[model samples]
Target: MKVFGFAGYSGSGKTTLIERLIPLLRARGLRVSLIKHTHHGFDIDKPGKDSFRFREAGATEVLLAGGQRWALMHELRDEPEPTLDDQLARLAAVDLVLVEGFRTTPIPKIEIHRPAAGHPLLHDKFPNIVAIASDTPLDVQLPQLDLNDPGQIAMFILKSVDLA
Candidate 1:
């Protein structure tokens, strides 16, 4: 699958943009999947749940299924964190994969930037960042997109990935 990424510091609206972009892309008849990275440890199974109990009992992996959907949780347990490639392999085939985070990975990315967030633009240092989406204009030579305009940003992403 073709892969594109969105990277930014906290509060830059990366998630919001992706949320908006998914339906637009789907409306164009493309299948999309997403892989999001989080620094904080997280769990989908709540404590006292059977899956949680199994995990607490040292199960290596747990699969939860129902009529509507299913999920698989694998335990790293002392293993090094999985690389972006490793995580990507877990996803089912799709036309495109939208990755959020994995900023250090070498991939075509659009950096979501908000000046009020007090974070510097990453495109300056990251050669893989092909565009910038911001709430305000920036002085860079690369393509600058309006952060508030999801339709325009969706077009930018479609063009960037050559799906336009």
Candidate 2:
């Protein structure tokens, strides 16, 4: 599967842009899967839930299955976090994988930049950044995309990955 990524600082509209792009890509008959990496610790299981209890009881992995879906939660415990390729191996096959984060993972990515967010541009530091999407136009050598134009951004992503 082709892989692409979105990288930006917090509140830079990365999630919003991805939310808009998913449907556009799906409508084109492409199966797209996403892997979002967050710096914070998170939980999908609720406290007092069976899965939560099982995990607390020292289960290394807990699989919760329902009629429509299933989720496997593996406790890292003392294990080092898995690499991007390792995480990718756990996902089902799809035409494209849109990674939302893992900025330094070496995947081709679009740097989402909003000057109003008070952050410096990242494209220069990260050579893997193939383009920049911003709310305001900036003078940069790389291809620039309007952050408000999801359609245009979606097309660019497809073309970049050769999925168009």
Per-prediction backbone clash count:
0, 0
What lDDT score goes with residue 91 in model 2? 95
Q: For all the candidates, what are their Cα RMSDs to the real structure? A: 0.9, 0.7
- For all candidates in order, the CA lDDT equals 0.92, 0.95
lDDT of 1 by residue, 57-140 (tens): 999999999999999999999999999999889889998899999988999999999999899889878888989999999999
Model 2 stretches astray by more than 4 angstroms: none
Q: How well does candidate 1 match the true structure in TM-score terms? A: 0.97
Q: What digit string (tens of lDDT, one per residue) describes model 2 on residues 14-104?
A: 9999999999999999999999999999999999998999999999999988999999999999999998899999999999999999999
TM-scores for every candidate against the unseen true structure: 0.97, 0.98
Spell out the clash pairs found in candidate 2.
none
